[model samples]
Target chain A: MFFRLTFSSIRHYAFRFSLAVLGLAISVASLVYFLSFGEGARRLIRRSVEDFNLQLLVLPPAQSLTVQPLLPRSLADSIRSLGVGKVYSILRLPYTAGFPPRAMGVVFGRDFSSSLRFISRYEVVRGRDLRDSTVREAVVGEALAKALGWDVGDTLTVGTGRYIVVGVVKAGSPMVDNAVIVPLNLLMEDMGTDRLLAVAVAPPPGKTEEVLSLLKREFPGYTIQTSEELVKLAKSFVALGDAIRFGLSSIALFVTAVLLFAIMAITVQERRWEFAVLRALGATRWFIFRLILAQALTVSFVGWLFGASLGWGLAEVTSRVMVEKFGLDLVEVSPSILILALLVSLGVGLVGSLFPALSAVRMDVREGLGR
Target chain B: MSRLVAESLRKTYGRKAKTVAVDGFSYTFEPGRSYAIVGPSGSGKTTLLYLLSGIEVPDSGKVLYGDTDLTAMGEDARSRFRARYFSFVFQQFHLIPYLNAYENVSVGLYLKTGKTDHGRAVSLLRSLGIEDPNRKPYEYSGGEQQRIAIARALITEPRVIFADEPTGNLDSKNSEMIFRILTGLASEGRTVIIATHDLALAEMCDVVLRLRDGKLVGS
Candidate 1:
């Protein structure tokens, strides 16, 4: 009887209840859509850090956080003389300063004389690897090639210099698969800069800590970071990004809760006589309270169903747009996101219906029946 | 069947204006009998019914049902007591609008037992001359709606039945039929207390009490 009464009341106000559901659905959709991007970016950064395969990175103290031309090219040789590990200099210049860094493709220049661990990991899917480091030749990642329609013989322009594409590479990881690579010395001369982004050091066998201690002592002014430190930094960045996105989505959730609350409050007012009748018929105050709560939860549960689908659909569209317009795929709708959306929507339902349920419980039965 | 006894019952309505709805009313209602409380407007017929049924707390009173004092119990306790032993029919019929005639009757059974007896509800509705028990309250006429309300009260098989103007909205024909049905329940060993304006229907009960100015005037 309790279940029948609750559902019957909801059906009685079907149109009003549907409006509340739609409002809640939109808020939950925004929440799911926003969090997807943060999750995607976090996953990408973690993969890139893991695949780098080097023991340490030597960066200029102030510019250690970003991958850009801030360290002198001589730092690679200075690190190499120690013989603790092989060294390589990498130069990365942004094509254009833009809102999203990935949209502005990087002019990635690295030493071809020694096999760069980062570049060696991916397979050369077409043409050949960068041969003759002095020649004006370049290699492009699979994503960058596909985005710009670059082929093996295509000529590409990067920072006032032109180079023929010698190879197309595939790295599965988005970070490496979205850059245009060239020889470090030629790129430096073409861009008219004697600086490099950073020097990567591969420690011999089990001498990682020994090499790190030696480098940190030798160049106290620089930042020597291990892969573990880089991963920790990435995790912190992901956490901050998640916090900001969730904060922005909270506004929509608040509005949704208020909308539901208003609708439920009005419904309670209209149904006062019915509640009084039920009480007179021997229903306890707790039963009346639970009936209102059940109605609210039903609305939210339906809203969550529609909202999760809409949010995931929106996330997919955003991912496609980022890939086509910005050359970055950074939106992931995971199972955890759906679960979180459900919990959040249910929370809204509970908050929205609390006052109305209390009012129903505290109603004066005699007055409500108009006796 | 349990005997109902009221001692010096008094109830007030407002704080400033202070309308005394029921005042100094005392009576002993025997079991297995029908009693009618007939009064004009604002004469406390409804308030006295409410006080006796534990729906309202009197300013000063002792209403005992078989040695259990209804006035001494808490609100929830009174509600439980009512659910376990009493049933009510109102002036407006008060059938749950969303429920069908059969569901309305079954709701009473559910309230009493925590589960419904569908067969008993259908039987009661049929006995009360509700031809289409599947119809909602709006589909029924005034008399049919009242019949559905009575069926709801009967489904619980309550020991005491309270009817406050049960046929107020019905025609003369339906009013007599309702009065006969209520009187028949008294013969079957259930206490029936009715508050009504129609003296003709009031005289049909075993005892008729008249009231004026919130106090009993004649019997």
Candidate 2:
């Protein structure tokens, strides 16, 4: 009977109830979308960093951005002797490539035979991998290939020498995906430099800190960084994204709460006589309070269910577009996020109904009936 | 027999002018009898009914129900007392707008006993000539609505039924029908008190008390 009365009252004011539900649904959806975007971006960055297999990069100390720093090619052998995993020397230089020669692109010179064994994240999506052929060949990242409109058998000028595109690759990381990769010996001869810019060493599992500490001690004048440090540095650059997401979500929740509060207050006022009738029929104040709260829970629960499903669908589509257009894996709807959204909606319901329920219970029966 | 006794009951309303609605009024009502409190407008007939029914406390007096002082009890205790020992029928009928005839009649039973007897509610509605138990109060005529209110009062089987102008909105035929029902309750050994302006209805009761200017003029 209690539930019937409550539901009947809700049906009596269906328009207002729907308005409240819609408002709550939109708020919850926004919260889920924003939080999922933040979580997805973080996961993408972490996965990209982890794909390097705890790799460490050794750079020259006090290297200036305007001047390319060079390290001895023997540094790779020295690092390999420290009981670490495979070590590869890389020489990176800015070079204009493509038919029209696009600007702001780097050419990474690597040992073609050992590069695949050392870099865990590299994967060829098109054409063939680099081989020890007499012809000069290059593997461009997916982004760089798209930008230059280059495919297999296509040739591009790199520092007065042309190399055929051997493979289109996906490096997972945006920075790496934008670069072109070629054989180290060919680039070194073309640049007239035997020195390298950096040495990338994949440390054995559970030996990252040991390798980093050993390399720092072995070469006091060099700068070394493990994958963990690089990942932390990358995350620090996107801290603002997280803060903005949190702020927007908080504002959405606040607006939901306010809208719910206003709707509940109006409902209570409209039903003042009904509450008085219940009181006159020997209903306790607590019973009236519970009835009001029950109405709020019903509205909130339905709204949350609808909003969560809609948000999940939207997030999936958004993630797909991001991956295709921006090459970013941003928007994953996890179970934890769904549960948090549910809890937040229920909390909003509870808080929104509090004042209205109190007012209903405190009404003077005679006055309400008289009105 | 159950009896209601009021001694020097005084009730006043408003703070600035302080009009006395009931002043130094006293009465003793016994079971198995029908009583009518008759008065003109603003003469405190409804106020006296409210005092005796424990709907409102007296300003400066006591109302005793078989030796239990109703005014001394807390609000919840007074409510429980009303649910157990008394039922009320107002002039407005006061039927819940959303509830049908049967649900409205069974509502008091649920409140008092924490359980509803659907069979009893159906029988009462049938006896009162209400065929459709699903029709809400708004769908019923004024007389039919009053009959539903009476059924609600009777469903509790209280020792006393306090009715404040129960037939005020009814036609002549309906008024006579309502008087017959109140007289029938009195014959069944339940006390029935009604406040009204109809002299004919008051005459049908076993006793009549007239009030003028918040004081008992005659009995």
**Top candidate, metric TM-score:** 1
Model 1 bad stretches (over 4 Å): A83-88, A96-104, A113-116, A119-121, A131-135, A202-214
Alpha-carbon local distance difference test for all models: 0.86, 0.81
- Which structure among the candidates has the greatest DockQ? 1
Error of 2 at A292 (Å): 2.0
Residue range A1-371, candidate 1, lDDT tens digits: 87888888889899999998999889889989999988898778766866566568888885558755788777888888888677878777766434554355667786875555655577899999877778999888888788767799999876678999999987777767787888888898889899878888888889999999999899999999997887778778888988998999899889989999999999999889888877887888888898999999989999999998899999999999888865778899988999999999999999999999999889998988887
Q: What's the DockQ of model 2?
A: 0.40
**TM of chain B, each:** 0.98, 0.97
How would you encode candidate 1's per-residue C-alpha lDDT over B103-129 as one tens digit per residue?
989888888789988788888888888
lDDT for residue A288 in candidate 1, whole number 0-100: 86
Tens-place lDDT per residue, model 2, A135-233, is 589888887677667788899777656889989888777545766778788887767787888778877778878888888899888878776766786
iRMS, all models = 0.9, 1.8
Candidate 1 interface RMSD, angstroms, 1 decimal:
0.9
